[model samples]
Each structure stands twice: as structure tokens, then as C-alpha cells.
Target: MPLYKTITPNSQTTVKIWKITESFDVLMEEVDLKPKSLERVLGMKSELHQRGFLSVRCLLKAFGYDDVDLHYDENGKPYLKDGKHISITHSFNFSAVIISDSKIGIDIEKQRSKISIIANKFIDYEFSYLDENALNYINKLTIIWCIKESLYKLFATPGLSFKQHCLVIPMSDNEQETVAWIDYEAQKSRYNIHFLEFEGFTCAYAIN
Candidate 1:
């Protein structure tokens, strides 16, 4: 199928998504798997993980880069040999990637009812737009979870707390763009957060 979504944010950044499935083998062939990378690739079991891995390779191919030469740092962040900014994610049967002129992050999540169980743990403000009587909208919670995940990937700072630090200003429930920010020490930077839903999944992207 055509990519679930393709986004061009200005002339510098592009994003694409795919629904994970057994058919991903066609896409998997696009990657150049070295021995070391193969070990990491073999450790992934679910379709989501494979699709996420495929996305990294697909993204590099899109930009005329080689996947075998790419590597990850100690924090598990992917780095390009030519210094291209890349971020990736996968959840259930969906995966996404964000490549940009600057650092970027992307995350996809399967909408789940359980997200409500830990809402307070990640959401600092009770979304005023959410109806008090309706506390179980799977889409809304998925958006929140995707937003936080996108932020984490952007910052690449592990100990950061989503609830206390990262925040989103919702524009809608099923479709919305939120603003995400992080404050550390005396410095603070904010990013434009974008969201889209497809094939029972929520995809979020963050760009500075």
C-alpha cells in the first residue's frame, strides 16, 4: 500500500508511515544489513520492530545514504555518517520516520484503552477539552502517549519525565497539533508537535 501518510514540512523535513504486516519483507530488502546490524535486527520479534528497522533503511535510501554505515550511540539514538538528522518509531503494526534539516523525532502508537489507566502519570493538566463524563476515549490518550514519545525521541534524554516536564496544547482530539517543550537548567526550547491517525494507530512528529 502507499505510505499511510507523507508529510513535507517546508523544504527540509519529510515523514512517512507504514502499517506493519507480514508483507514488510518487500520493504526489508531495501536495507543493507551488516553482520553487527543483523544481530540487532534479529533481536526484534514483532512486526512493529521489523517495520521500524525497515523505516530506518528506507529513510536512508530515500536520501541516497547507506544503512549499513549508520550506527547508534550509547543512548540508542541513530546517527548518520554524513550528519543527517533521523528519528524513528514503531508500535504494533505501524511505524514512522522523520528526516530533517535539523534534529527531529517521530513516534507511532497503537491506540489502546489502557492509556487512560496511566493518564495522570504522564499528563500534568487535566485536558479541559476532555469531557469529564467521557474519560475513556482511546484516540485522545493515544495522542498524549504519542506526543510524549515524540518528545522523548527528540530530546534523547532518558530521565526526562513526560508529565512534569513535557506538555502539549491540544487543538483537537482525533486531529490536532500540539506544542512540546523541555526546560533544563537555564535553557528551554520548544518544538512544533504534529499528529495524525491511520489504521488504528496514532503517529506523532516533533521538529525544532
Candidate 2:
């Protein structure tokens, strides 16, 4: 089933990661998607995207819920009908879902050198401590990017600039967790962030 790894970050949270290796047809055979979802997948021009979409449904099934129990709001934030907070993310070959009792967000990103090219766009405070000559510089940048992306998904608020609003505390590659803040419009909030790397990809999630 390619359910690569599962983590119970806390008593109230469950994270399920799927490593997509099956053909699209195989995935389609395993999931029963709503018409909208089916159409959305079909409309995608890239098979990688289609497969990633289906894998998310497969992870949902592992959680004992199907596409019927999942939905999204006007802001494009996903939610569960059973009242649990849900966040999702997928990169080229991996996809993950995090369901928690409190608001949460998840993101999976491939560790790429190009992330440094656009680092300035989403990185500001963290840049103060990032050493470009460090062996894990790219790794650190990818983690920060994943963290901010997760924060965006959690906040689901428009006009929240990643560089200007989100701040991740300094940490090394050996650290699996850290703290981050979202300071926007005088409503300041702190979140506990955790992340891990596997097979050249980084997966991070933020919990409110």
C-alpha cells in the first residue's frame, strides 16, 4: 500500500505519509473519490500530480475516512466533517496528511538547490543564522521553507507574507523540532513545529 511511515506526534495528532509507487490505475482502484475530485484529477495535465492527489485519498483511507469526510473551505483549507483539523502536502514522490485535535498544517518538499535561489522571498529572520558555507545549508533552507509553507496552510489567511509574518527560530539539522511565530496585524501566535527528512525530501508540520 506504500504507507511509508506513520507517526503519532502526540495523543491528539496522527500523521500518515505515503510513498507513491503504484500506477495511477492502481491508485484509482483503491479510492472512491467524489465527482469533483475525480474531475480535478482527470483535468490535471501531469500524471505526477494526479498520482499525488490519489495518494492523499489513500492516506485518508488509512485514517478510516474517505473522500466523503474531507472537504475544503473558501480559503482552500481542508477540514474533516468529524470536526478534526486536517492539513495535507505532497511533493514529487511523497504525500502526507496530519490530523490533529487542534489547528495544524503540513508540507512536504524535495530538497533542492534552487530553494536557495528564492530563499530571500520567504526567508528573512532565519537568514541571520543560516550559514551558506555550512554543509547542511540547503537542508536548513528546505526545512524553513517547509515550515513556512505549513504555517501558510494552517493560517489560511490571505496577505500573510511568509518572510514578513513567519519567523522560525534558529536550529541545526540535528534538531527535529523548533518554534515559529506568526505576527500579523497585532494577532501574534506561536506554534510548535516538527520535521523529518527521508529519501531526499523534507516533511514538516506546524501545530497551533
Candidate 3:
């Protein structure tokens, strides 16, 4: 059980991270997935994805839930049967979940220079504050990307453009939290953004 870290961001919110190290067979044996979930995992083409999927079930168990308690909406956003807000994310070797009484979203991404290549596609207002010459350029971009992704999951709206709709307020590398806004289809909402970096990966979550 490589439950790497857990954080209670607020009384109503819980975040859990899992560091995947177990074999697929071991993970399969440990978690009792619903038939649909079992089929989904078995259909995954990549072993890494299958492990990440199973590891999320492992995390759910830690939260006192199981595969049957989770389901997805038409938008493919996950939700809890008990009506708590839930968001999930998984990268190459890590997976995370954030559950809160209020609407929330979470994302985990591996920090890499490749993000810089696609920066223009997802960044707009943030480019003004981002210094390309800075030593932590990739890190900063990763945070912004993660923040926008979390906001996307939170909104779960179709045709939401990250570049045009989501705006992450500028913040320094030393800051653990910031604010962001979503302006889409004449509707607007604000959220508090929190982020963490570990082992070359970044995780961000948003709460309204």
C-alpha cells in the first residue's frame, strides 16, 4: 500500500495520493471492482493505465468507499453515490483524488519540457506573467496547466477553451495557492487553486 501522502485541505475536503509500485496482478487481487470497472481496466491498452485505474480503487478503499460507490456522468466526470463532490487524476506513476462537500476538481501531471511546446495552446492571460527565461519556466507552466485542468474538471462543461475561458492568476513559485476564474458562455465562477510538486510531478486542485 504505497499511499504516498494525504492532506485535509479543509474540514470538508480530503486529498489522497498513491505512488504506484505494485504489479497489475497484485493490484487486481487487492481491489474488488464492479463489473464495469473490471471491464474498463481490462480494456485498457497500456499496463500503466490499468495500474493507475486500479490504484485509484485502492485510494477509494482508504477513503472507505469502493468501485460500486463511484460512477461517471455523461461528461465523463466521476461522482460519488453519496453525493460528495469528487475529482480524480493520474499520471505515469501517481494517482490522486479530491473529495469535498463543495464542487471540486483535481489534476496530476508530470513536469516536463514538452509542456512548453503546447503552452501557447492553453495559455493566454497567464503568458503575460510567465517569464520564459526563468529557471523554473517548466515548473510554472506545469502549475498553470494543472490549474486549468482542475478548473475544466470542476466545470465539466463542453466546448470550454482553456486558453479563452480559464484564467489562472499569477503567483510565485513559493506560493502554494492562488485564485482562478472560469468565464464561459456568459457564466462566471471563481475558485481557489492549490498545488504541490513532488518527484518531478505536479498536482493541483480547485474548490469553489
| Candidate 1: residue 58 lDDT (0-100) | 67
**What are the per-residue Cα lDDT tens digits for candidate 3 across 1-208?**
9999999999999999999999999999989988999899999999999999999999999999999999999889999999999999999999999999999999999999999999999999998999999999999999999999999999999999999999999887688999999999889899999999999999999999
Residue-level lDDT of model 2, residues 131-192, one tens digit each, is 99998999999999999999999999999999999999986667899999999998999999
Please provide the root mean square deviation of candidate 1 (C-alpha atoms, Å): 2.5
Candidate 3 deviant stretches above 4 angstroms: none
- Which of candidates 1 and 2 reaches a greater lDDT? 2
C-alpha lDDT score of every prediction, in listed order:
0.74, 0.95, 0.95
Error of 3 at 22 (Å): 0.6
Error of 2 at 162 (Å): 0.6
Residue 118 in candidate 3 has what lDDT? 97
Residue 18 displacement in candidate 2 (angstroms): 0.4
List clashing residue pairs in candidate 1. Answer: 20-93
